[model samples]
Target: MEYYISNFSNVKKEEVKIKGSKGSFIQWLVTKDHGAHYAVRRFTLEPNGVIAPHVHKYQETVIILKGSTKVCVGREVKELHENDFIFIDSGVEHAFYNGMDPLEFICIIDYVDDMSIHPVDRSCI
Candidate 1:
């Protein structure tokens, strides 16, 4: 299979903007164009940064690489720390938020087209 390798530091970081949120997120990614059905990216949330509850047409997962975060699924909220992993089923409403310190994690999701992936926001909290 055709392939490529990249270090997170070698990738570009992007900002995350939830429709009605005050804080934002940033990411470093390894996309599917290199030959994979899914795309993975690292997300870093500034204090109070929130990823409004959103649904994925496809399943999604994230691993806490550093720092900690607060994740919400349905009505339950969970705290995640380094080495923790969170899995979200397709169509499930989920989101991430940071506490006092910045939080960071790596997210994995099905890859469709770069422009077609819009995580639909839903009722969170």
Candidate 2:
């Protein structure tokens, strides 16, 4: 297999708009320029924006590179600061939000076949 470095500057940042979401919320700069085993992505959460509770097909790990955030897993909510990290198991329902300023972070996840995100509600908690 070939190896290389992917830069955030080169990847297009895409907005993550959930179907039932009300406002402009999640944005992601994603890159899959390396091995297929995983994907590296940087996310920016805008104030008033949100990532509604959802389930993933692959396990995910996110590291707080900059800014603070509020993460919700099930009915539990916790505040996270810079340098913090969180792990979410596959099929686990969760969500996160940016505080006043733009919250930035890096997320690495097992390469998914289709990156299927199933939007869920509090009832799933």
Candidate 3:
């Protein structure tokens, strides 16, 4: 068994590219434990940042931690604040926008055995 705590002091921050966008930021804190082709990541988005619309072959769940956001799943759009959560089913186009200051959340993605088989297409942005 593996155990770990991702305190802000030890978590590494990285930038995520937003396709066709001028500016955006995403910080990630990956957990130490890995499940069957799945992973957990703590993600933070800056104000006005967007993840862009895209779809994956696997499922994903997002748990909001701070600030607020507008999430688009399929054809529906919903505003989410702290303590809110959302689930994105496989093959559904989904995206997130950080509209209320800095947004922090955790994203858990379940994948198949080979990640290469489930390529992420970012053409719908």
Please list all clashing residue pairs in model 2, or write none if there are none: none
RMSD of each: 2.7, 3.0, 3.5
Collision count for each candidate, in order: 0, 0, 0
lDDT order, best first, reads 1, 2, 3
Top candidate, metric lDDT: 1
Q: Of models 1 and 2, which has the larger lDDT?
A: 1
Model 3 stretches astray by more than 4 angstroms: 21-37, 114-125
List lDDT for all candidates, in order: 0.73, 0.72, 0.69
Give the clashing pairs for model 3: none
TM-scores, all models, native as reference: 0.81, 0.81, 0.76
TM-score for candidate 1, residues paired by index: 0.81
Best by TM-score: 1
Which of candidates 1 and 3 reaches a greater TM-score?
1
Error of 3 at 61 (Å): 0.7
Worst window of 10 by summed lDDT in candidate 3: 116-125
